[model samples]
Target: MSDLSPTEVVEIEICRRPIFVVGSQRSGTTILASSLRHHGALWYSTEGYILNEIFGPERLDETYAVARLNLNRWLAREGVTREEFLERMGLGFNVLLSSRSGGKRWIEKTPENSLMIEVLGTMFPGACFIHILRDGRGAVNSMVNKRTAPGWVTDITWACRAWRRYVDAALEYAASHPDRCLTVRYEELVADPEEGFEAIYQFIGVPYDRAPMDFFRTHRTSSSFRRRIRSRSSHEALADLWDVWPLQFKRIFLEDAGVAMLRYGMVSEEEMQQMVEDARDPSDESPSWTEELEGYRSRRDLAAVVERGVPRDAVMLVVSKGDERLLELGDREAWHFPRDEDGGHPGYHPADSEEAIARLEWLRARGAEYLVFPEGSLWWLEHYTGFRDHLAARYPRVVDELDKCMIYGLQSVRQVPTA
Candidate 1:
C-alpha cells in the first residue's frame, strides 16, 4: 500500500441508469433499437427478459404495494432491509450491464417493457425510456400476418386489444414522467428519419450523428412480412388488409382500439364511423391480395441468392426497380441499377439496351464487381437483349436459379470488343 501510486489504483463506476426502448410488438421498436445501436456513445443489447421476471409484478398498480410486499419477504430472508436490498440489486444489475457496455451508455429494448416502465423506473431512478407508437391498424395488421409463436396474440380482435393495452399503459406513464419518457410515432419517424433521430439523440443526451439515418442500408431486420407487403405501396397494403376484414373483426377493432387510434391521431372520428359503414356492404368479389403478396414474396427470394453468392465487402449492382429493400439483404455494398452520376437513383430506366449496356460498363469501371437480376427485374433481360447478351458473353454466371435470380461476376471478366 505504501508503494502504490494514484495511477495504480483502480476505480470502477457502475452505470445505474440505462436507456430503454419500449413499444407494442411490430411497432418499429426493432428498427429503432437497431438504429440506436449505431451511435458511438451507446451500446444496445438484445431484449432483456430477465428484468421482467425479476422486477415486474403480476399486477402493476399505482402504489406498487404487491411488488413491495413480495420483495420485502425476500429481503427479510436475506437479512437485509428494503433499502439495503435495493442498493445491492441495483449495483448487481449495473455490473451485469456495464460488463458488456464497452464503456458506453447501454440500451435495453423489449416490447413487454412497455408495461413495466414504473417498475424499471423504481429500480433505476435515472433511466430514460423511449416509446414508439405505431398506427394500430398497421401494428395489428403486422401482428396478425406474422403470427408469432408461443403465447403470442394471433386473432385480429385480440391483436387490436393488445396494441391498445400497450399504448395506453405507455402513454399513461409518459403523462406523469414527461422528463423521463419520450414518445415517438412510427409514421413520423419514417417520414423524416433524420429529424426524428436527431430529436431522439437530443433526448438521450448524445451527440447527433447522421449514421443512424442510414440504418436501412446497414441493419438487416427479419422482414418476411415486409417482403410480402411489397406488392403495393404501404398505404395500399394497409387499405387492402383493412378492406378484407370481416364485419365482426372490423367492429371488434373499432371497439377495442378506436379511442387510442384517435388519441394518437391515426384516424378521425369521421373516418372511424366510415369504416363501420364500409364493413356493412361486404363485396362478394374477392381481391387477388393473396396472390399478389405471394408474387412479391417469391420475387424477393433472390435476396437469399445474393446473401450466399456475393462475397462480403464486394460491390453489387442490383436491378431493384427503385426498391431499397433489396440493398439491405447482404453484407456486400449494393447500389441501384441505372444510378445517376452522383450514385443515387436516376429516377428513370435506361432509354434503350445501348444505354443500359453503357451504364453497366460505367458502373463496372467504378468498382461494381457483380450484377444481379432478381425475378422482378427479369423483364430487363427480355427487354434489353443487347445488355443481357453483353453480360452473358463477357461475365461468368455465378448463380442461375431459373425462377429466383441470376448473378454475373464482373471483377475478372475480359471486356469483349464491340462488334
Candidate 2:
C-alpha cells in the first residue's frame, strides 16, 4: 500500500507532460517510440501498452469491457473520480517509469490509443499526442507480415478498409483538439528521421536534438532487439513498400503508400476505385482456409503478449518443441527466448499434482516472460482441474484470459497490486 493516504495520492500528479503516440495498428508507432526513446527529455514505455493498463483490458473482449456491473462495482469501491482512482491504482507503474525517466516526462505508445482521445485527454490534461500515419497499403501489408491484424481483418481490402475507419476516427479526435495532437506520416519519418524527429519534438514541446536519429548506434538494447527495431533501409523504400499478398489481395504495392490513403477522411470516388483496383483484379492460388486459419491462430498467440510491449530482453517460453518454427518470417521474434538446446518441451506435467501453478513459478524462475500453448497442444496440462482458471482467479489481469491456445505472460499477472 502507498504510504501516502488516498486523498494525498489523488492530489499528487504522477506524470507531467505525458506523451502518447497513436495511429492505426502496424503504422510505425513502435519504431517511432523506439527512436524517440533515445531523446534526453523522454522516457518511452518498454511495456508498449497504453493508458488502458490503468483503465482496463482486465478482461478479454474485442470491444474491451469486463461487465457493466463490474465497472459500477469498481467505481463504487475506488471512489467516483475515476482519474484519481486511476492515478492511485497506477502509482506503482508511475513510480517505476519516473525512476526510469531520467527526470524526463513519460512517452507512451499503443496503437489502440488512437481510439482513446477523450479518456486520455481526461487523464492527462494538456498531454501531447503524436499520431503516425502510414499508407493503408503499407499498413495492411505490414499487418499481414506481422500477423497482428485482428481476427476479422482477412485480406488487403478488409485491412485497408479497417485502416480507413480507424484513421478517420483517430484523426477526427486529434483534429477536435488540435494543439495537443500532431500527425506525422511514416514515409516522411523514416525517410528523414532527423528532420522528422525535430518536427515531432517541436510539436511535443521538447528541445529538438540529434540523439534520436543516431539511436541505433548510441542507445543500449540487446543485439536481437536492436536488430528488430533498426530503421528501415532507405534502399527498401521502393516507390512504396510492395509485397504481393497471395491470392485475394494480389500484388498490391503502394510505392507511395498511395495518395488515396491520405484522403481516408475525405476520400474522393476516383481514389476509392483506384484502391479497389490495386487490391484486386489479379489473383494467385489462395492458401487453403485451414492454412490461413492456422496461420492466423499462430500469429494470434504471438500478438497477444508481444503487442503489450515488453522489455528488449523479455523471453518467451514456447510450449512445444517445434513451435519455434513458425517464427521464421516476422521480426517480432526478437522476444523469443534464446534457443535453449536445454529448453524445449517441459517433458511432462508434474506427477505429484496436475496443477500448473508450481510449474508456472518454475518457468518464471527460469526467466520466462510468457508461456505459449500453441494450437491447444498443452490441453492436457491446462485442462487439469481447470488449472488455468484457478491461477487466473487468484491473479486477475488484463492478460488473465482462459484460452486453450494462448500466450500467458508471467509478467501479466503481477500487474495488479496484491492489496
Candidate 3:
C-alpha cells in the first residue's frame, strides 16, 4: 500500500467520528447496537462485511496483532493508507446505509470489538466506546444454549474466560480513557432500558432521550429474535451452569472469574466465596487451592478440570484429556496429536513449521474445509506467543478467530505454501 498525502488523510479522518459498541456474545451488545442504530443522528451495522476485510473474521483472540496485518491489506485493497483506511473502515457504514442515517455519526458493533479496543482506538483516535458486560454465568448459559456460539467461544469454561477478557479490556480502557468510554452491564441494561441508554447517551455526549429506548422496545417485528435477546430473570441460570458445564470449567468460574467479577462488581465477595466453596474439588483437601491457579493458569489446565460428561460433547474436537470419559461421542473422530497414557497433551500447534505442514496435509486428506481450535487452547495466547503471527501470516486463509476459537480453512491454508 502506498502512503497518501497528509492533507487527504486528514480530510478522511475529519469525515469519521464513530462510536463502537462491544461486549461478549449474548451480552446484549446486539440489542444495544440495534437501538443505537435507530437514532436519526447515527447509523449502525449489525454485521458489516467490511470488518471481515479489516480483520479476517474478527480474531478477538489476537485482535490487535492480526488486525494490524489485515489493516495493511485492507488499505492496499481500498487504495488507502493507514489513516485513510481508519477513516474509510470506521465510517464506511455511512456509504452502506447511504442516505438513511443522513450522514450522521456511524456506529458498529461486533462482540469481538471488546477484545479489539486497542486496535479500534488506533483506527479512530477520538471515537467513543460503549462496552456491555453480562454476568459470566448468565453469558455462559446463553452462549452454550445457542450452540452456534462464535468460533472464538468454546464452552462454559472458555465462555467465562472470554467474558473476563472482554470485561477486563473494557475496564482497563475505561480507566485510561474515562471520557471516551462507557461500561454497561447487560442485566442492568435490560432491567432499566431507559436508565441504561441514558447513561450511554450521556457518555457519548449526546442529549439524553427516552425515545431510542422506546424504539428498541417497539421495533420488535420478529418476536423470536426479540425474545432470544430480551432480558429475563436469570437467577436460576447459575444452577444451570453446574448441570451444563463440566467440572474444570466450574472451577474456572470459581477461581479465574473473580478479578473481573470483583472489579466490575458483577458478584459480591460473599456470593463468590460461596460459589468457590461449592465448586471445590472433593479430592483436594486444601480448600484454598484454587488461588494457586492464578498466575500460571493455562487453557490446558482449565480444560483438565472435566472429570465427567458435559452436554454438547459432539464438538469438532475436544480439547482435554477426558474426551473419552466426558464426551459421549459414538463414531466421530476427535482431532488431537494422539495423546499418551500419562495424560500429557500434544505439543502441536499449526504454527510450528513441520507441524503446520503435517496438520494441513492430514486436514486436506480428510477433505476438511475448516479446523477449530477451542478458545481454551488459546485463552492466554502469549503463553503460546507466536500463535497469532502464524495465523495472521495465513491471512484470509485463516478465516475467523472470534467466538472464542480459531478456525482455519484447509483449502485456503493449503494454498499458503504450508505456513
Candidate closest to the true structure, highest lDDT: 1
Candidate 1, residues 154-219, lDDT tens digits: the string is: 687789988988887888789889998999987678667888898898898999787777983456
Task: Show how many residue pairs clash in every candidate, following the order shown.
Answer: 0, 2, 9
Among these predictions, the greatest TM-score belongs to 1
lDDT per residue, candidate 2, 40-121, as tens digits? 8788766457356545433123222333236666655555464554444446555566677777888877776676555666
Q: Report per-prediction Cα RMSD to one decimal.
A: 20.7, 20.8, 18.0
TM-score of 3: 0.53
- Estimate candidate 1's alpha-carbon lDDT, on a 0 to 1 scale: 0.76
Name every residue pair that clashes in candidate 3.
Answer: 150-403, 151-405, 152-402, 152-403, 152-404, 152-405, 153-403, 153-404, 248-305
Q: Which segments of model 3 are wrong by more than 4 Å?
A: 1-15, 52-100, 150-154, 218-249, 287-289, 292-419
Full-model lDDT, candidate 3: 0.58
Better of 1 and 3 by lDDT: 1
